[model samples]
Target: MFKFWYANQQNRVRWANSFSAEYRLECGVRQGGLSSPALFNLYMNNLIDELSRTGIGCHIDGVCINNISYADDMVLLSPSVRALRKLIDVCESYAATHGLKYNATKSELMVFKAGSKTYNTIPPVMLCGRPLNRVTNFKYLGHWVSDDLKDNADIERERRSLAVRCGMLAHRFTRCTTQVKVTLFKAYCQSFYTCSLWVNFTQRAYSGLRTQYNNTFRVLMGMPRFCSASGMFADADVDSFSTIMRKRSASMLRRFRDSPNTILGTLAERWDSPILGRWIRLHAVK
Candidate 1:
């Protein structure tokens, strides 16, 4: 049945109103198909197994996590440059034998350290015989990951995004009903993207986001700048920024705890085991 579903697939290109002749697909799964992601995961299972057997990555409580992946995007983790290079080599060999290719240009190397020191002393990372770009920061899974592992840059970016969304909502929906405006605010302005991962941010940095959040409600309600917004949030049944972040972090922890994924669950439990841990310390349940 599976083979029948994927057999003899035909596709056509639509240019404006004109349609090109249909061509039968000789290889690969259908683009945007419902089963594509699952099929891709099955295809990559062997590669994941091989990498796991290499045992060259961050080790926690006897468990090794060499890579973090979501579909095609992957981040390789290792304690040292040499170990990371070995992981890359293994991946390259697997890809070469499997008729796959790596985009060396899109690949980047980032060295995480304790302090605000420069990474110039660290060795370069090579992929497929080409040097990958070394970056101080990179966006992964909708969040900014910095070399220093600080969340200030990511928080500031989220604040700017929220500010733009607030302005957009106000400009376009000023005449809408209060209830409608509130709905729009919740849909667009209320999202603190990846706030659950904000374990290393300054209070002042987050306070800025809270201020912007309050201003969003003020703009939506047409309240004066100096007017007290003390009970306004509660009155509108909207959670405060801090409360929202806390809830998101708690939700993330719950998902990790409930997930059946062995690798991810092990990693999360290891992090949560410590009293002053990452996911646990910030939103620890009493």
Candidate 2:
């Protein structure tokens, strides 16, 4: 897929008042001086190239559940654990060749259902969060299996977007030479101070649950939640900081055609190469 930097990482908040910058910058393209949005696709493409000669389509394998492949979490429809294990082998091999590590604990598999369709979902990871759910967040191919009541995640996202804009605006005003009383306002006005409260409240709750009520997390909170809190929200509950999966869409995988992270482009190429497909199926897929 044509992966773009997420909104959070794709920030254009003016950092310097002395120099008016573009309020909005499209990331992924190499631009001089701007480094907020790391061009992660460059690295992913390298991995794709390595796997293409291996003769594996990775996820193009068939998944059947209730007789339909369309699912909020279609990846979970692999029929049995053996199939999932095969998928994992493909993943490990891909990681090994690309000089990357797949954190298995975080790189787990979960199954969810909406109506009759099954979904496969991946929550966010620690340290460096991936966009498994958002354009900026690490979404597996930028999509996941989610349920109907999960609208709260979008609400949380809106709250976070507000905070980023407000934080940037507050910082801009504080640094502007033309803006009078910069010092006075910095010391007195708590304008930007409270902007992240919503972000914090949800984050704190997630943290609290992570340590004590992890098992009963959903029951305790009485609802499913996702964190879009900027770095401001630290120590969140396990899945609180993820974009849960939703109905699968071809559009979601459309970006895969050009993204650096395509398992198909890499593995399929390798599979098409003579001898590699036999090697993997005989040795790796055992």
Candidate 3:
């Protein structure tokens, strides 16, 4: 762990007129630095500890998860609406004590199982003395998360976005060679698959993405949209989008297995039987 030393804390900048301005950055980590995330995690350690003591987060098989934090972004979890309110209260108190504040306008409430009768009667939640706006869908970590936990909406949105990006790429790289165009697509558009980690990808969604993938390659290679491109793909030695998704999913599963104590790991263990089903028994030696 990098120690937060006085010497390392010094930050200064020069803006206009050859003049220099210096100020003590007494809070938060440096933006865009390699070690910033680690430093921020260290800074948030105390807050996490405090929240853990509250016993207000989601509890599964005796393990409690009050919240998840990635750098400064946070998602507080609770089993009940009342408990969620308390959790937010604790969060607000912690922030106040730590010289931090919530962006109430940006903060929102999303009730899961929103169609349940219990949710209809639940009171509104407030943060920073203002009611949190209730939303049916919100984007988290660049993926749309809906109240129903369905991926179709998110997948359609991503498809449209990918189409728009491919259109722009086609317009800008009209003179570029096929190889160069493929390279650009790999660099810029591959993340569309990479970022879709938690989506429950339906067959329709997969087909749509695959269609887009094939069309993008076809456009780049100056081939008709209906033309077969198996030879082109073989020549480029690029994996299909489906293959990439499988590889990424397997990699993610391995990571989940490694994270034995995390919520994801716990869920993975709980669902192992259902996930593997009779396949595990079928593959096992007698």
Assess each prediction's global lDDT (C-alpha) against the native.
0.83, 0.35, 0.73
TM-score of candidate 3 versus the correct structure, residues matched by position: 0.80
Better of 1 and 2 by lDDT: 1
Worst lDDT window (10 residues) for model 3? 274-283
Predicted candidate 2 versus true structure: per-residue lDDT over 1-286, tens digit per residue: 3344444334344555654544555433435535423455454544434334334332343311211112111232343445544444555566677565654434433444445665454443221233222221222332322343122343344345434544554455544442243333223322222111122124453443232222222222222444233221222222222221111112232343456743434433454543333333323442
lDDT of 3 by residue, 1-286 (tens): 2454644666677577564667767766667778777777888888888788898878877779988877777888888778888888888988898789999999988877744433655688889999989887898776787777667767777788888888988889989987788888788667665332434447797678778877887776687878765766777877666556555666666676788557777756765444333223323523
Clashes of each: 0, 34, 0
- Whole-model lDDT, candidate 2? 0.35
lDDT of 1: 0.83
- Which order, best to worst by lDDT? 1, 3, 2
TM-score of each candidate structure, all chains considered together = 0.89, 0.28, 0.80
Candidate number achieving the greatest lDDT relative to the actual structure = 1
Model 2 weakest lDDT span, ten residues long: 63-72
lDDT of 3: 0.73
| Model 1: how far residue 270 lies from native, Å | 4.0
